[model samples]
Target: MKRIMLTLILLVGIGGYTTYAQSELSLQECLKYALTNNQQLARIRMEEDMGRFKTSEVRAKALPQVNASGQYTNNIKKQVLAVPGELIQEPGKTVLLEAGTTHNVTASGTLTQTIYDQSVFTGLKAAKAGEEYYSMQSVQSEETVIYNVTQLYYSTLVSREKMIVLDANIEKISKLVNTTGSQVESGLARKIDLDRMRVNLTNYKTQRTQAQNQYLVQLNQLKQQMGMSMAASIDLPHTSFKEIESKAVGALDFGGVNLDNRIEYRLLKKQEELQEFQKKAYKAEYYPSLALSGNYSYNGISNKFDMFKGSGSTASWYSMAAVSLTLKIPIFDGFARRSRVSQASVTLKELNKQKEETALALNTQFENAKLQVQNNLTTIQAQKENVDLANEVYNSTQNNYNLGLANLTDLLDAETSLTEAQNNYNEALLQYKLAELDIIKSNGNLKSLLN
Candidate 1:
């Protein structure tokens, strides 16, 4: 029986340790896992690959293409015609003349090249620009992912911290209940004191339970974002004033939204440039297309059915080469070219307006994030003071209650005030973090934070 009891105690201790360990995950591990294993990142990378392939496909038009062909013909009868009367110098007798049909088999190999094509050149350039756009978009997508990961990381961190706080509170209340129970058993303290301690202990247990639930939920959320298994658990480290102090919030040194370096800005600029190119591309159709084409062929003509004829009967082979210039001028297309150029011009103007709007929006968001961080820094200090003051008041109230100078109701009020202050301080810290993250993202610099 003693051995079984000992085994039961060991099992309980192991279970408790496991539950304790599941409460936290480190920030670095979370970020690393998130960036390296995320499905969204993979999808964006695939898009980048697709863009690259499209550019390659466009460029391939400049390369040479080779082809081989063969033809066979058989004529069952020869063609016959009447002799011309002018050749005979008389209209009297007409004679039938037969031009024998020839049986022939021919094979040829040819190569065609696009030496210069205005539309192909324009398309290749546009494809290159498109590749650049998608590449930058991938970078921006990565930055967005990193920002989300940071927010979730901090949220999980705060939840775990709250859980720790609640557990400590529960432990303190349990100790109080034990003390009150002893006093009541000895008939010194009233049974009402014991009941009150028990009630407070229950409330602490409820709060602790809620905190644990939040912690687990946040952990699961982080795991999901990191592309880990749903059953995977994470353990995060504790954060303290020392940790916060160790990190520095640097100065905001934005060069005022460089239109060229910013990805979204550059993408818009490229779109406008591409539209301008498209206007010219469409105009290429209005200009006549000129191509110089040449073909060299060898043909063998035979009146006999046999392809390999002896020298007595003749098999003649002819070689020919010709170069010709072909020109196609479009005189009418029902205003298609005119309408396309107009549409392109309109689109370019719209992109120009969109760029201006984006620049303004970005500047506004940047300034707002900076001001928010600065303002919240001040509020954080005040919230810290509030928490300190509430803690002191609660401690004093407890002391006064032990001395019979303060009532249970007063202690309860002090506890409530302290709890609210703590929650407010926690929320302030989270808000400050979110504000800082906003600045990090607006600057397009999330890689340093996550990777």
Candidate 2:
């Protein structure tokens, strides 16, 4: 019996844990989760790392480069050297003697160091700029992810609230249908009225099903934006209509949005910076470069395989060394460097144009977002009042219908009005939230959402 009780207790504990695991997630939690798990953001981070490695590679050019080489040869047929016979005291005759050893081995090491290379220096600077460019891109990508996730999160919340409203309407109308049927049986209500109530109840149920399905679809989309698994069961916390209205009403103004705050504008500026570096790099090609090279080698020659043993004078080994400094003057290249510099200057001008355009566009976005925020705030207030009035009318009509002072049609109409008002109010809140998110992004404060 004790074992049975223990098993029951363990089962209950597991069930509770499962329920807790699937509990509702708030907006902050969702944003934080996306930042950590988003696949796109992860790729951007890897690209940033690639930029750093690229810079390292360019810097490596300035360091001394060393290499080793070895070769072994076994001559099958040595070439004969023909000499004048008179020189060997044999008149009017030619003599032939074989040249070179049967076996030969050589090993060498070399080092090359750049003393003054204009191109390598330019490349190092360009690489550093590229790394910074990638870093900015990463930040921009994160902001985009945060904006998308926040938008989807609130959209899902709105859909869920609509579904809730429909469910409540169904429940209320179902009760009305039951009451009307009893009235018709007792001769207090006509059969037509009972049938009408049943039809309305059926319609509400159908509408509720659609609303619930839409809510489910939206929830799945929210999970997708959050980088959560499709197979995972998750819930979103419910936000009341009144709370939404209050939040919208209290929307803060981010006065005088700075173009520098917006990541898009900053990215453009960073591009301009990189283009300037590129222009300098192209111009750097006109300059000369100097390098120092050193080499050391060991040669071994023998008629037998005894070079490593160094046995007697039959096998011989010698060491050779050389050092030289080379200067490469860019005398001419068919005016290629001049043409490249001209193109870079043109590109810089284009980038300057882009920066100007981006600045104007960013300003326009901020202004439009602020305008929308104001408009949504007004709509939310009006809708909030409409909802309250509709609820009052619904309650009064419902009570009157119960007392036979109102017809089923009037009650149904009032319920419809209430449902519309509630949905409109929720829609206004969603628009306001979206506009607020835009304001935050335009002000370069999307990361504030995580806080």
Scored by lDDT, the top model is 2
lDDT by residue for model 2 (159-265), tens? 87888888888888787778777878899889998788788778888888898788788867766776666555655545664655665558564677888888888
lDDT at position 34, candidate 1: 69
How many Å off is the CA of 374 in candidate 1?
Answer: 2.0
Residues 1-451 of candidate 1 have per-residue lDDT tens digits of 0000001111332321212222333455556656676778879989999999999998988676566667766756878888966676767777777774577666665655666678778888888888987888788776666777788877876786777777767776677678778878998678987788788878878888898888888877766676565544456656664333223243444434444545678778877877877887897777666555566666666777666666664667666666666676689989989999999888988998999999998778878988887776667677778889999999999899888888877877787787778777677677778887777667766666743
Deviation of model 2 at 326, angstroms: 0.5
Cα TM-score of candidate 2: 0.91
Q: Candidates' TM-scores?
A: 0.79, 0.91
Model 2: residue 93 alpha-carbon error in angstroms: 4.5
- Per-residue error for 391 in candidate 2, Å, reads 1.1
